[model samples]
Target chain A: MPELLSDAFEQVQRDVDAAFDAFLPVPQDTRARLVEAMRYAVIGGGKRVRPLLVCATAKLFGVDRDAAVAAGCAVEAIHAYSLIHDDLPCMDDDDLRHGKPTLHKVYDEATAVLAGDCLHALAFDILTMPGTSSDPFVRAELVATLARASGHEGMAGGQMMDIVSDEEEYDLRQVTRLQQLKTGALLAASVEMGAVLGKVPPEGRTHLRAYARDIGLAFQIADDLLDVEGDEAKAGKALRKDEGQGKQTFVTLMGRDKARAQAKMLVDQAGEHLASYGNDAQVLVELAHFVVKRDH
Target chain B: MPELLSDAFEQVQRDVDAAFDAFLPVPQDTRARLVEAMRYAVIGGGKRVRPLLVCATAKLFGVDRDAAVAAGCAVEAIHAYSLIHDDLPCMDDDDLRHGKPTLHKVYDEATAVLAGDCLHALAFDILTMPGTSSDPFVRAELVATLARASGHEGMAGGQMMDIVSDEEEYDLRQVTRLQQLKTGALLAASVEMGAVLGKVPPEGRTHLRAYARDIGLAFQIADDLLDVEGDEAKAGKALRKDEGQGKQTFVTLMGRDKARAQAKMLVDQAGEHLASYGNDAQVLVELAHFVVKRDH
Candidate 1:
């Protein structure tokens, strides 16, 4: 099972990388700066969590795995764009992302911001391209899902909260609400998109939703755990930046030990959703474990 | 006809204003900053060219006028978002918008950036909400159109070219190419979306495209003309910022008289395309004239 999961993961990564490469625009002389910035932000290193969810969720439904791969790449483009904008000098003001200099840090903030804007548009372009989805309705749903997830009630809304809540003390409940929209909404959409695009039954979608929600929370908790316990070299972020920034986080809300346990419980629930799919979702299960177990 | 146009314009304005007021996110204490930035970027100013295009195009198909109004407001939201981001300290660094302090100037740059992000997402949200469109496919197409227009090949890409081409000399062909994507694409989408959502025939879409393309260029050229001839208070921008920045523009390439002639021809061609829609498209003709004839 472990070997099979590894193979699937490797294949998913290759497919996503190729799709992204194909979708990027040519960096002509006049537009070269913008294109270069976009390429730098997107091609920059990260786990590709959203893409993996898209592919894995589609694969579970036994549908067009290629469509899933394309969608996965598209979602990642949006994710990368968000990260680029979030790290601008004026926004989150981060100098680094995924352990490397942020796009603005590497290539001026204006380009970084515009590149992120382009990537957001590019995600929808990928989802709605002529051959990407044969069913117009499905294609439309794909657009709707992605747009909603990326917009006000989803990631953007969460970001607004994150910026405003910097100095405020929020209880775990409020923090979780923000995290659910900020981090978890897209994660849920990643899974839901795979299911819907693959034409999975409603029952299957419900289970996957549960699975994605658990994994999403678990992923954030694991991130907090890493911030507390991991290294600068491994995590590519300052080890205690969250604490130093006076930001609210799961680790700060629940003690370190409790956060770790919560992560484990959520991962366990994600696994429980996979029981009906059995070995078919082996990669997804391994991914859940990887989320909780990773140092970074 | 002028009185009727003014009446329709006023009615559209009230309805659109009401639409925005109805749909805007509540200014809760935590998210007040973001909400304020969004309201500032959207309310009280700008010509509403894109929104008017949406309204006129939808009117051609005899759809409920309110649907067009909703779409108009949504696209304006997107256009407004783009303007806010463009004026950010890291981007254009402009201090003023619509004769007032820019969003980033009034609020912090971080809030301004996030406001742009949130507004972009909100446009999609408005277009996709169940109330926005009766057909799910129409909803999807609206999402897809705005996304494509906003992405790498559209406004974002155009902005990139504008940034990179500042010092370089590009010929008329290259300049027009950049203008088409940067400004033309979204304008085209504005008209095309009305037709698409209204279920206008494919041939009608073709006609609308030609109309939109011509007027879009005309609008840009007229903008160039305004830079040369209009007052600073009226234009809400420092006159000749284009020349000062060493940017290429239509007025720069052709003399002011020639640019005006070119704009008039385009406006005439845009009006000609409405032959297919017959008397139903009077509003569209007025809109085309407004694009070329407006002072601000």
Candidate 2:
């Protein structure tokens, strides 16, 4: 990775962490157990790739940095909450995340559930906070956009499909549809929300959407690649479990070599969507490449 | 109940059910399993009291009935999601609700979690839908209000407290705070969202808030009283379980006679908040009384 791009990623990660730490309920609050669980899951963890996308996209249109961070944190909170829930015994039942005990393991199952639930609600609250924007209409747009991405036909719907995938055989199209819902939706929303924060008009949004859509798929393929042959220490998770589960993955169907080539193609294609923005969108162009190249 | 009040309550119930039927994802969708779980949990259960409260309060300010119903369903969706999560084996772990099998029992635990999470996201989606309001600010307020009521300081927080409640003894103030968060928050938001839809001014909101606050306690006490005294067939779930769990409840903390009396007093006090509205609020006043009177 280039120094400048790597530095930008670290900076956004720090910003998002600070935003999360500052916004979370006080440690001494009455419901501190759940709040503590929320903080544990969200802060000091993850790649912050989603927040980087928000920050990078918002930068393209000169949105205020703090407002963008607030928006970034909102998306990251949802991402974190989804991870916490997804790792539940009933779901993925993973024991570790970001190199630490998962929320349920650290705090018990009930706290984990409430922590995830509360964090989901807190994401909307953070977006609507005065710091995000002076205009409620803009906040409403963010809420509507994020909620749609997170709800049925989006992230949650996709998760359901993934669960059912364990029972059914799915062709490439079905797999793509499942991938689009399970992971792509929120990835798209992160970029879309940044555009919303920037007050970018409808036509301008299409460009960002196009960019998000490509990167989202590429990101997933990269994930599959990681699962097939990732260093668990670097990734902070159990890898190769997809193959162990006897599930079809990019590597399973298209072979690792082909999947790697496809991811590169997607990263390159994603960059084209940002062509009209030129110099203003350099960070986003860098991010598209980063998504496929990240070790974790 | 008065004849007119009973008829109004039935109308609200029907309106909420019809609204839910219209908004839920189609049963034939690719990921219909989760969506189907959401529909089963929401459409065929509860007294729709939260929705009715929203409709009744919005009617006070002459808001459009359908728009009010949209807001009503938004709160109901949140309520439904909370119930689904609360019934998880890690949480309340009940097998029945509203005379039907709980979601996790009917559909797998994973489906229940996703359905609950998805329904939660859908609540915000419905509030922002064009059908809810033409005003973006109102939609934003609705989003903010519902999110706040559902987050750490609200329903989710309350759920956490309930889980923790088993570990430690609680006094009156602690118990009051717990009840306020677990149950009071959403009930309060139901009325508050309706006021937002009706475009009621801040001062007018105070009265509605006062009514909600009083009724919130009364409602919980009524539930406790039902557990101790009411029929299981009509209530549609286990009763006296709070006692079995040795958890502190209004009944345990205050004693049944005192708890029952306090509930009646709260209902009467709730009615006092609406005195200024005269005949326009007659239904709300009667509804307050009915809450304490209902068997289920």
Best by TM-score: 2
lDDT, candidate 1, B1-296, per-residue tens:
37766777777777777788787767564676677678777877777778778888887777777778888887888788889888887777888778888888788888887788877867776877767787877877787788888887788888888887777787888889888988898899889888976887677588889999998899889888887788888777667778888878999898888999999999999989888788788877888888777767
What TM-score number comes out for model 1? 0.95
Query: Model 2, B54-116: lDDT tens per residue?
Result: 999999999999999999998999999999999999998999899899999999899999999
**Poorly placed runs, candidate 2 (over 4 Å):** A27-30, B27-29
Judge candidate 1 at residue A2 and give its lDDT: 64
TM-score of model number 2, chain B: 0.97
True contacts kept of 2: 0.84
TM-score of each: 0.95, 0.98
Residue B240's lDDT within candidate 1 is 70
Candidate 2 per-residue lDDT over residues A1-296, each given as its tens digit? 77767898889989988888888856454588888888898888898888888888888878999998998888888898899999999999999899898999998888888889988999999988888998888899999989999988799998888888878888777777888888899999999988898898878698889999999999999999999788999999888898778887777878989999999999999999889999788888988998898888
Candidate 1's DockQ is 0.69
Which ranges of candidate 1 are over 4 A from the true structure? A27-29, A201-204, B27-29
lDDT of 2 at A76: 88
User: Top lDDT: which candidate number?
Assistant: 2
